[model samples]
Target: MLKGIPKIISPELMKVLLEMGHGDEIVLADGNFPAASCASRLIRCDGHGIIELLDAILKFFPLDTYSENPVSLMQVVEGDPATPTIWKDYRSAIKKYDQDFTSFEMVERFAFYERSKKAFAIVATGESALYANILLKKGVVVE
Candidate 1:
């Protein structure tokens, strides 16, 4: 095991993060997401919550500075009453790494799935929250 790496990150996930280049995107998929069908590369993080995974990933993953919205969240259907309070938790976690990070771009449900199909990789987590799926764009690491 690596000394500084978070125990939550599996070896395969760490390798995927290392292989990703600037502009590539990765998805943190909720339990409800169709991860298997949508992912180009899939990493199973079963029994893990998105909030904790988000926090752990941000420790080493850089957000795309070139994109207007480096972070994107799946939007709830128009008539759906689910408020997705977990989004605030996600925002808080992101702010810890990037103080300037504000809001996430809301992508339509179908669009989100389409985007997921093209993502560099998708992490299927055990989070039960509705609309918890998030896509993070990669950025170049600065020296």
Candidate 2:
């Protein structure tokens, strides 16, 4: 019901994304994630895919310039450098937004889980695509 906000983002998600400070990480995860078990706070955007959620969030939140891992993705198993189709879409979306962010570093699957454990909140999307999970770091808006 908020003006200038994506309808896909629920009020709870909006609150978490807005309230998160610098150094806080937010996970936009696939449907397979154990959201309740891992999330300190869980925001479910059931009908929306990860790309839609990312588009909405990036509209307001800037990627953290302070961290090398401003964006991180789960790596393909064992030397498979071929990016997943979902990741290609994400890259295109980033380019469309004219963001300076060009690359997403890959992390081991377990490492991703460890990182997610430390996230402030996890926004679970209904994306069925494999390897659709992404972690975003919140950045400060400098005046």
Query: Which candidate gets the maximum lDDT versus the true structure?
Result: 1
Per-residue CA lDDT of candidate 2, range 1-143, in tens? 76888888788998998899998999999998777788888888886899988888888877788887688898877876655799888888766653677699898988898889889999888899888899988887875
Q: C-alpha displacement of 56 in model 1, angstroms?
A: 0.6
The number of the candidate with the highest TM-score is 1
Q: Which stretches of candidate 2 lie over 4 Å from their true place?
A: 79-83
Global fold similarity of model 2 (TM-score): 0.91
What lDDT would candidate 2 get against the real structure?
A: 0.84
- Local distance difference test scores for all models: 0.95, 0.84
For each candidate, what TM-score against the reference?
Answer: 0.99, 0.91
lDDT of 1 by residue, 23-95 (tens): 9999999999999998879999999999999999999999998999999999999999999999999989999
RMSD of 2: 1.9
Task: State each candidate's clash count.
Answer: 0, 0
